[model samples]
Target: MRILIVGGGVLGTLHAWQAVERGHDVVQLESEPEARGASVRNFGLVWVGGRATGAELDTALRARVLWERIGERVPGLGFRANGSLTVVRTEAELAVAAEVAAGAEAADRGYKLLDVAETKKLNPALRGDFRSALWCERDAAVEPRVAQPALRAELARSGRYTWKPGREVRHLSATGVVDDRGERHDGDVVVFCTGAWTGGLVRELAGEPPVRKVRLQMAQTEPLGEELTTSVADGDSFRYYPAYRGPALETLEAGQPQSKVAQEHRMQLLLVQRLDGSLTIGDTHEYDQPFAFDVTEDPYEHLAEVAGALLGRPLPRIRRRWAGVYAQTTDTGRIVHRERVADNALLVTGPGGRGMTCSPAIAEDTAEELNL
Candidate 1:
């Protein structure tokens, strides 16, 4: 089968990788010269501990294994098992941490609640006054700058897939795609992994409902000079990810909003000290339609303040600041849709913000769905 996959985000790359691995001739096209959307702009977390404790939880668990398997199957992918530390600063935050631990237990996820001393022991960077931490041993992190391109290189090296790096696909058909250059390459199937750009492509393909893009703002700090055992965040970050939100969303929705920590917002601080000394800290979600991306300095200041409060260490240097965008679902979950007329015309998107950690397994399933 000759498959033409549109949009070379994480999911697009996954589709191409799996289809090629399964003996299909796959061709992946992207609008940007490189990945310009949320895939490259995230904290690169392969979350295993924070997903809702049912099918979503189960899938995330399997997804963790998938992240590991990729490293094994294709070496140098840079997938790391650094784990993650979710901290608690207040009684309410501690309750939320306990809530997550309970969900992990019910879902048979291997996680342990860390007391104050234990939390400090796990991450020496943790500071301020914190009550507890939920440690999920299997959860991991990766460097997207290394991993995504590595996967793309692996697929290209296999020679089973024809990768067109700068090809901007303007139109898609059950057969193949018509490139921006007025070139058409017929194929057996078409899959759109456009991420935030899915809305436009959906209308072009005349598909159901639609996919939307949400902007995420993040910042990276200079070398922290310490090895972080895992990615870390608090209850504020948990509520944003549906997997972490769990079955208590209704309760959470009704919960009163706390006083503004700063800037009229109170998101928990998230941190992942990469293999490099630099700590990858982030992120605040500011949902917008077609054009809602502005990487301002205010979010960075707020992030540093929160991180300082959590890590108990003043960041001396902020080497970089940036933004990311990902596909969002009305239901706030990943959407994997198929057009009724063409079984091969599949739309793999709606990851919201968890695409990095979740796409590996999803890509495997996508290949299966395409029967490649």
Candidate 2:
């Protein structure tokens, strides 16, 4: 089978990987020279701990295993099982952590409520005055900036995968697609994994999907000068992840309000050190459309303050700042908005923030569903 994969992001590349690994030829297309979307602009976290129970958590766990296997085969992936820590400063926040850590699913998510001593001992870089931390040993990280290209390189070695970038699909045909160059690429099946790009070809084919675009602000700082052993997040993160929702979380939310800037921007501090030693920190969520054309400063300021508080020192000078948008299903229960739009074509997207973490498993599922 020759599969036509539209989009060059992680999702699209992983789909290609699944097809090629199954002895099928794959052709992946992209509009830009590289993946210039949320796929590359993310924290590269294979986050499992924060996922809601049921299908989402199951997919994350499967993806984590797939990532480890793929990483061993493709060293360029830079996958690391360094884990994560959500630091809590107030008693209210500590209570929330304790509840979740003792939940029935704690073992599956690798949740452990760590004291101040344990927290600092696990991640010595955290010398701040935090009360305790919720440690998730199942969490991991990868190099987002290079992940797609690295995967593509491995797929190329398969001799059955072809990548077509700088080529936009202008028309879809029963057999395959016709690109802007007026060239026809034939295939038995066509899968669109077009990230946040929900307009143009995608809209023409599938109409308005049951997905919304999300915008976020993130930044990278100069080398931290020390190892940050684990990825870090603030207790404010508790409000965002569904895994921590309980009575304790409710009390914490009611008693401990976020700072004005943090609340207004819906911000959380998630810091991860890159292979270069630079810290990738973020982010704030913006739901309404007509999103800001430029990145705001307030969120960054809030992130730096929280990050400094955790490190017990000032944050390194920020070297880069940017904003990215991703598509998420408005129907939160669904992991992605996948559907067959045409006889030979299917659209799979809206993994949202899970794009980086679950693309591999998602792609594998796509293959099994289509019998590819």
Using TM-score, give the best candidate's number. 2
Candidate 2 lDDT tens digits, 279-338: 999999999999989999989888999999999999999999999999998888888889
Per-residue C-alpha lDDT of model 1 across residues 222-290, encoded as one tens digit per residue: 888776667888657656665556445446546746335432433546787766778877776555455
Name the runs in model 1 displaced over 4 angstroms: 103-107, 199-201, 243-256, 259-266, 288-293, 332-344
List the pairs of residues colliding in candidate 2.
none
lDDT of 2: 0.94
Candidates' C-alpha lDDT? 0.71, 0.94
Error of 2 at 202 (Å): 0.9
**Error at 41, model 2, angstroms:** 0.8
- Winning candidate number (lDDT): 2
